[model samples]
Target: MIFGNFVSGLIILFERPVRIGDTVTIGSFSGTVSKIRIRATTITDFDRKEVIIPNKAFVTERLINWSLTDTTTRLVIRLGVAYGSDLEKVRKVLLKAATEHPRVMHEPMPEVFFTAFGASTLDHELRLYVRELRDRSRTVDELNRTIDQLCRENDINIAFNHCGHFTSP
Candidate 1:
């Protein structure tokens, strides 16, 4: 009877429709939930490593579940543009790239802000809400690539660290 009751409790906990195969972040570690057993749940890391954590850990730890029905997620990209670059042009390009990206959310739209002014450059920040946090790395890579391409096409120079480059006129 005790064993049956335990099994029943397990079923109730693990049977949560939104609980399994969800992308979740606990602290700095983020992964997709793989399995839920009677005593523990398994998560597969980005590198495909499995982590077995007790069920109690979920209750005790702070967790960010990206798959909890609401798929909206916020993404930020920081960029440093050359000091002389047109701020409005930079803002326009950033917003355009973000909006055009396949994974970026359109309803919420994208925002560009002048975050700060540095010695060699002007720092700008772009914020957008995405539908899935699981695609964070890929989205970021694509965004950066698109930004780079746009910058080149628009003749907007990106700020780089101090490094001497040989020039022959």
Candidate 2:
């Protein structure tokens, strides 16, 4: 009878709704699932660190699973451009970059927001959904590179706050 119960428990544990290899965020740490044992699970952190967490803790903790049956993830990119830059042009460039990226999702579409007016620059936010979490880094790199190239070609300057600026007259 004890052996039967143990087998049943194992079945229950293995049949959990959360599957192996899901991208999950527990507390503030986010990682990809490496293994799902009967009693615990192993996840590989973004920095390649391994974390072993008990299965029971997952039941009681708040976990954000990015790939639960659906492999879509939302990404937000924030930028601060100089005050003189045209808002419409900035939005167009950011949206164009996000949509043109290979990893970005097209069904949900990309959006750009004029977030805030700061002392020196205008804060903008770009949001897009990606279907693959593994390609996040590459997508971000491409997006930033595109943004920089577009800004340079259009003569739009990204903003940075410094202590002082010396002008030669």
Best by TM-score: 2
Clashing residue pairs, candidate 2?
none
Global lDDT scores for all candidate models: 0.83, 0.82
Residue-level lDDT of model 1, residues 57-157, one tens digit each, is 56556877888788778889999999899999999999999989999988888999999998888999999988876677789999999999999999999
Tens digits of per-residue lDDT for model 2 on 51-105?
Answer: 9766655665687888887777788888999988999999999988998887899
Q: What TM-score number comes out for model 1?
A: 0.80
The TM-score values for the models, in the order shown, are 0.80, 0.83
Q: In model 1, where do residues sit more than 4 Å from their true spots?
A: 1-18, 163-169
Worst 10 residues of 2 by lDDT: 1-10
- The prediction achieving the highest lDDT against the true structure is 1
For all candidates, the clash counts are 0, 0
